[model samples]
Target: MAYCAIAVIVVLMSCFFNRFRPLGKMLVIIALLLPQLSKAQKTVAPLVLNNEQLPVLPKEFYVAAVTDERDDRSAVAWLLPTTEATSITPQYKVDIKYGAQAAIKQFVNYAIPPDKALRPVIVRIKKLKLAESLLAGGRVEGKMEVALSFDLKRAYDNVHLIDYRTSSIYNRIEGQQYDVETLLRHTLEAGLIYFNTWINREADTNIKLAKGVKLIFTDYTEQPEGDTIYYSAKRPLRWEDFKAVPIGGKYEASVLPSIGYNERVEIINGIVNIHLAIKTYLPKSASWVRNGSSTNYSLNHEQRHFDIVKIIAERFKQKLMSEKLPVDNYDGYINVDYLEAFREMNIMQDQYDNETSHGTNSYAQQQWNEKIDKELGK
Candidate 1:
């Protein structure tokens, strides 16, 4: 019995040791792979550009005017400096009028997943009304108006009335603070929806065909004689191509914020006035990508640039139409103070880029201008 007991004990101990050894080895392997796994997880594929992403811009038929603080007057209400509305437009109000529409359009782009099916996503905005007056000291002291703006020519069967609302009153207070941040946020939301509605109206026909914005290829040659670089789009852009491409997205689709290009422009004005040649450049990592990947953010950034430029160009043309100016030649196109516009656009783009927390330098601005000077026979 004693011999048998010793045998059983030795066998059990060997089995236990064998099991623990494998577990220990597994733990070491996991420790070794943890860092590599983390790095691999961070690797993202580049965005794929397809026909669907191409932006289709409106022609001479489409025109828009945005006169901030316009002369449209309704019922007049005055508030003393001591007593002003503490609130801006209500969150629900803005959401109903414009926010919901913008949100819906964004959701449609990505297609709300099955898990999000129950959640109500904004698709389009129709009617907006002032539910209640934002009163000051229990008295009506401000004019809060919402105007529905739409591109009459482009909007189709399902017309989304993009609302332009304001929360301002003839207040005796010169600089009265009335929930300014909240007001601004709502204003921005309204602006985005209004702009996108116009873009959607213009782009709806082409959106189905567009996979992504087609990049404008550039050709650059160093001129040794002039000590300059000549640049142009590899292919010339004609007005007829507007109908062939997709133009915008849902929710502020017409414009996108940028940094590199903005910084380049700033560098020019800070030193010397210069021209600019603009085209999309592919990142090295992106050159290999053939399919769309969320990880590949560069492709998305470039697409955004293309989309914004398309919208701006359309708006520029619209402005020209209003002025009864020709939109045919390079001189006419360049006549608009595009430098100032680029700066404003850059500010918006930089803010958006900063929010993404991506480390990208804003030097596209500097190179673009130098390239343009070469085209101008400088």
Candidate 2:
């Protein structure tokens, strides 16, 4: 028994040492090499732009922007035009004709010729070179083009329902000498990030489907007879070519639902005179107002409204696809899609009323019931 115990102890020790010897060696090596490896791995992505690096853009880019010295004490600039000016409702031919001409003339300082009066003005602009100075600190030179093109607003429903009350310039409106420059930098950074995010999402979707979607930034512009800005994929877009247009929020011109076949376009001072043809649809049923207090919950509710709408749209589309229904089945229901969309919209509204307002199902339910009754009657 003593001999057997000694032999078993020796065997256990041998096995333990054999297993731990390599592990100990690996730990020692890792402890010795980790810092060096980390140092070696410190590298930057090639496409990333440093603070001082200038972006390469085309030379012929022309940028048109608006300035409000009071709002942010900075100038407002956009790759797109002013949203407010385009919101001019034109239900009549005279309004459509003269309104468009007036808008174009205000910005471009040119008359929309009677013969070419009906064509949407299209423009394209890009950057020429980097503008470096004590102020800019050797940043990418800002450049862009203003184009006027198609007014598809006339073809789509709800063109005038919301009334393009949201007027904003793409540039920051602070009066500092570097305000515009700063605005340009911010716009470029934000725009690139946004596009990259969109690309990433598209890539993920494509990979799952075993397909790909290639989208390049281009400065494509289209303007027909009057004042139209048409952009396409063929044009090369520079970092400064795309301008950010704020569509909604506090101090917005108006909130309008973008309806079928129509999109309201805005440029800094560009002309796009189209009329609102449809009557505005009031929320008679959904008594859910935006959260009154400026708390995070209120903000969350507003954001949730947007998020929920997107989710509902996706779900509806998925349903349609699963049923093998053509996208055209609801073509006739474009105007009425508002009704269907609101079906899910109320969920967020209810959440807002409950969580944000802390209302005991009083105001929200009452308002919601009214909206429902109105819709049902219609």
Q: Which candidate is the best by lDDT?
A: 1
Q: TM-score for all predictions?
A: 0.18, 0.19
Cα-based lDDT at residue 150, candidate 1: 41
lDDT for model 2 comes to: 0.29
lDDT of 1 by residue, 64-131 (tens): 22222324222111222322335653222122222333432433233212222121112222322223
lDDT of each: 0.33, 0.29
**Full-model lDDT, candidate 1:** 0.33
Please identify model 1 stretches exceeding 4 Å from their true place.
1-65, 68-78, 83-143, 152-177, 180-185, 194-198, 206-378
- Residue lDDT tens for model 2, 30-108: 4575555443322211111114322322121112221211222111222111111122222111111222223223333
Q: What lDDT is reached at residue 349 by model 2?
A: 49
Any runs in candidate 2 off by more than 4 Å, and if so which? Answer: 1-297, 326-338, 355-378
